[model samples]
Target: MLSIYIHIPFCVRKCLYCDFLSFPASERDKEIYAAALLKEIETEAFRYEERLVDTVFLGGGTPSILQTAHIEKIMDTLKNCYRFSSKPEITIEVNPCTVDKEKLSRYKAAGINRLSIGAQSVQDSELRALGRIHNAADFFAAFHMAREAGFDNINVDLMSALPGQTAERYLETLLKVTGLKPEHISAYSLIIEEGTPFFDMYGEKEGENGVERGLPSEEEERRMYEETGKRLEEAGYCRYEISNYALKGRECRHNTTYWRRHDYAGFGLGASSMVENVRWKNTARMQTYLDAYGKGKIHGNVKEEIQRLGRAEQMEEFMFLGLRLTEGVSRAEFFEAFHEDMEKIYGPVLQQLLDNGLIDTGERVKLTSYGRDVSNYVMAQFLF
Candidate 1:
């Protein structure tokens, strides 16, 4: 399946923990960016004109910050440029403060069938501490507005392991969100990046300016993670993939494309695309992208970096990426795709993982719950 991603790198306020390319921008700046994005999409869509697009994800900084008409223009342009499935899973990532009921109505009218709302926490204090521009009330309002606007497929984005977060408090957010019964939910743990405010506050030695950030202790974070899974599982939301829970038949198809190693095209600022066995990332610098696109550089060569994968590279990626799924990678499919037995190349490693009780060696290999706890380390063993 072929999917598409559009990055909107404009946020109302950059959260303290954010390391994505999004930042605060004026309406005029966003409009200009959208225009540039349109140009890129119009030019690049032709390359995949023959492929029936399965999903189109409008991810952000915050896509809802765009005016409804701008969104409509982009969707219209995409429809004009490519062949989409009769029922494409078109999703837009929305920030609560940016969209009202009327705006949500406009979004529905504009063909956004799914909404991924960023509602990080339910506590007003945590919202402020996380640098979120909206309070819990704002999220509730936005969520109900989307429902009133007729969105049946919605995903609420939640974060755990935040500073000053307790296991009970985090569980409360999970329980409260699950009560809404959105079609999907994505929960992520806070990882401190080197340059962000979070890292600065917690990175240095305690004797230095690195006072306690009130970050959840590692053990508390582990409890939060376990409870997250247990609660969601009991709520009837299947843990289809790590970090995501969905009703059966309601997984985020666009993201699944990534984990399943399907081809996709990405547009807009700092987007990444992998098609025709080559992976490339767009230039992250806003002015740099604008300059190139402004000069008619929408072709494949416009990206910041492009790399072609060898057979070995592809196989490793297939194993690691597929392992991220609860179902794990299929050995038969691996042989069919690469024409080599997966066991032949990674037999020893697989045996080790199985012996350690980190993975199962049935018809397909999958991670155990213990494996998922050290998944980063487990997955890295696949790299050769």
Candidate 2:
């Protein structure tokens, strides 16, 4: 089985904190980009012919911003290019403001079996602070509209530790979204990535080593994370991944493929893929991608940057990505895949983590409750 990812790199307006390869484009530009994206998908599918693509994820700069016709064409192209599993899990990432009853209905009609609504916060004030176009009202409307369109498998995205956010406000977001009973919830803590408005505003300190302003304290952030797990669990959504909670049997299969280190192909601008030992990301520049599409080949420079991971690199990724899940990695599977005993190679590192209560050193190693709080450190030890 294989997974396919399509990246739609157009947004109505780039959010303040977003640093993805998304841009504001006119409708005509969208049409051009969509045509090119379909071409890439066709070319890649031919390279790996006849394989069953079990999962397809349309993620973006808000894929909902694309016209229904564009989406339908993309779906049609995938079906024509490859064999689909009998029960393909097709998902589209949508923004609250970009969709409506008709658009969602068209999505269902186009074979999108899942919806991931980017409802970052349920509070209007927080949404405004985050420079998000949509508000609480918009999210509710979108949620109901998705349900009305017959989407049973839905994932609501939320963020905690936001600027000017209190513990009370974070809990409010959790309670409100969970009350809606979406099949999954991705509650993430805000990270101030570089080259974004957030980094410019808060990344600089007034004086030497001055404390960061407007953000919650580390202790406060910890509270928000812990409480989120408790609240979502009580609401019947189990914590599956570090930031993902889902009802039983409704996890995002496409994302799970990444964690399991399975092969996946990414299409469109700035899309990346890990097929066997080779890993590559498409050109992020718009004109570059268009030029490549025109020439019927990915640009030479972009293709030249491809990384063929060595054995150590593969093991590092296998451990780091697999450890993000609550179920963790199996030693047996690791040996089968890498032909190296995990215990023999990493026994001391595993012992150190276990001694500090970061991971459970069992047949299948996984994070302890306390370990998940400091998962970064645990995963870093696996790095080559």
Mind giving the per-residue lDDT tens digits that candidate 2 earns over 70-98? 99999999999999989999999999989
TM-score to true structure, per model: 0.96, 0.96
- lDDT by residue (tens digit), candidate 1, 46-66: 688789998999998988888
**Model 1 global lDDT (CA atoms, 0 to 1):** 0.88
Pairs clashing in candidate 2?
none
